[model samples]
Target: MYDVDTRKRALALVAQGRSLNSVSKEMGISRHAITNWLSRLEPLPRTPPCVRCLESPGIPEDTAAYAYLLGLYLGDGYIISKPKQHYLMITCTASWPGLVDAAEEAMRKVLPWPSVNRLQRAGCVDVKSYTRHWVCLLPQHGPGKKHERPIALEPWQQAIVDAHPWEFIRGLIHSDGCRITNWTTRMVAGERKRYEYPRYLFSNKSDDIRKLFTDALDTVGVEWSTLARGSDPFNISVARKASVALMDAHVGPKY
Candidate 1:
């Protein structure tokens, strides 16, 4: 076993961005031994049971049962889980052709009511089709009147939104759909401007559903702008693109 001083030193090295392998080597300890010591030294804190469990009678028991079912679905859904993973789970069901509706309904039923509202206020559910499979994503909320800047996306969510297009394109030539692509910073009139909102783009082949999509965008008060004209000559599909531009362009850029 390593001494307390050695453990503290190793932790400090890790805080300074030193690799675990390098830290173990520097401390004259085996990497596996260091990993074991670290795991034993501090275990991750467990999530507390939902507050509803204590406040509402009977609801907790039902919620728990639903959560268990949800966990099973998550384990067997498009994504799988690990043997050692432990987390609270919840499940909901929707019709086959209505995946987006199902996801929203499931989320409403499974999550605490407050959480559902928070998710909706942040951004609505987005549905995308790739390689014949429908993928739906619930976006995070943007900055509001109280907040000076837009909220940042979680790393996992950001990765999914960023990489999905490339992954889809690589898999099939005809695969195209709406995607949230970039978060960019720009300069306007010698002032630095930060735009933290997610940008949505519709591919050329999405013409079939453009009207349906545009109506939804209008309902959300999201204004669309044309970034480019015409379709890719090689693709021979009319690619009409639109963007939200900024979450709070009305607020203007902060100096």
Candidate 2:
């Protein structure tokens, strides 16, 4: 627990453009507490921290866990900000308990102080946490669908993508992309031959998001093809034997 003076100091530092990570380390306070304190401020200060001040070191620019979570959030998560509170929320199919667990682990690792709750509603599992730093990590948050507006990663997020493309791909495929088997029968030689193969399919309404997904796939040398007609949603797929093998190794069914 911190005193009134300590809380005010923390808020003042944060308002000064200091990162919660750096403030927590220097002032010996948890980022979670710092976030809550800042949220309570009646009038938020507008001064963006000058990096030159060198007080707030900020978060890790690139981490596997962070990269993975970013991809997952981009694919299936959102930010919720209320008058008194804000949070990052991710919902997954209730059937995929393992995926929920994986997302929970990533949140715990990325946030300084992470608290996750598993709520059930309409056969979907909602995993969420309150942390102002989520905005720091995912600046693409705003009104409207990602496709309706613009979607781009910050420089720091790009660094994370550059460092751990496979993990990002894994997260994307696990959350929004999927592996499916296509079967067909054809007459070969004298009799009909039955064949089955696996392919990875990713669907999103946003073109920018589709590009990000395919870019990550390219980073890991996984070949993908776009399958979409005019005025339809964007889709990318990986169907080659070698590519399927690679993706299967990294991404599997969630629970």
Candidate 3:
């Protein structure tokens, strides 16, 4: 059992905006313990007002985080906003604990007052934040599958994406993209030598969403091409050495 001082320090770190996962790792304390401490001391409260609902509605203060979340939402995330239920859910693979933590942290940064939780499934974890104002922030939430509908960013969101292109790219990569290396053996003089080609691939069936991703790539000067299998163009690939370098510096591989 942790002492009073330990609990205080953990809460203090959380108050300073550190994530529960990070705090738990640092203090060697389980997140359940820290959560129990918070629940005992903090009172149940109403959900906080969304910034977009203010008299003078404005974009989220942390535009970079918002842009990143937007990319993730468009990639594989979704929002549910029934009368009694409202939340944003981003699914991260269970294997990537760091990515799951990062997803929850981004949710908190974009909307600090929401209650964020994780739902673990067979091979993935859904990082969800409960709030009714998700619709206010993510206007793209709609009734059908994302691929069947038009996906266009509002001017304000576009501005944010333009400003923080790398974060947006990182979120997209983390959600629906991957970095891989392909190697082939070739004859060098009399010996067979192996060479590796590293590339980044983003696969999505939605035309509009793919356009948005490629447009962002264009803005960031990352050379990419549509990779086709047989007759279907279904993936975007960054195979050029310089473009791969740029993507590595910005997005890297998911944890």
List TM-score per model, in order: 0.23, 0.76, 0.81
Clashes of 1: 4
lDDT of 2 by residue, 1-255 (tens): 789888877776555445578578768999898888777756455444322233654555338888888878888999876443456878888888888898888887776453455667898888886655566667889998877989998776787788888888878776788788988899999899999988889888888888998888888889889887686858888999998889888876557
**Per-residue lDDT of 1-255 in model 3, one digit per residue for the tens?**
888889887776565344677578878999999999988966334455788888988989898999899988998799887654577899999999989998998999999976677888999999988777888999988999998999889898999999999999888889999999978899999999999999999988899888999999999999999999888787999999999999989999888
Q: Give lDDT for model 1.
A: 0.34
**Candidate 3 residue pairs that clash:** none
Candidate with the greatest lDDT versus the true structure: 3
TM-score winner between candidates 1 and 2 = 2
Report each candidate's C-alpha RMSD, comma-separated, in the order given: 18.4, 7.8, 7.1
What's the true lDDT of residue 134 in model 1?
Answer: 10
lDDT, each prediction: 0.34, 0.76, 0.87
Per-residue lDDT tens digits for candidate 1, residues 105-174, read 4434433321221112122323211110011121221223212333333454333323332221211111
Cα lDDT, model 2, residue 139: 83
In model 3, the Cα lDDT at residue 67 comes to 87
Q: Which consecutive 10 residues in model 1 have the weakest lDDT in total?
A: 128-137
Q: Could you tell which candidate, 2 or 3, scores higher by lDDT? A: 3
Highest TM-score, which number?
Answer: 3
lDDT of 2: 0.76
The clash count of every prediction, one per candidate, is 4, 1, 0
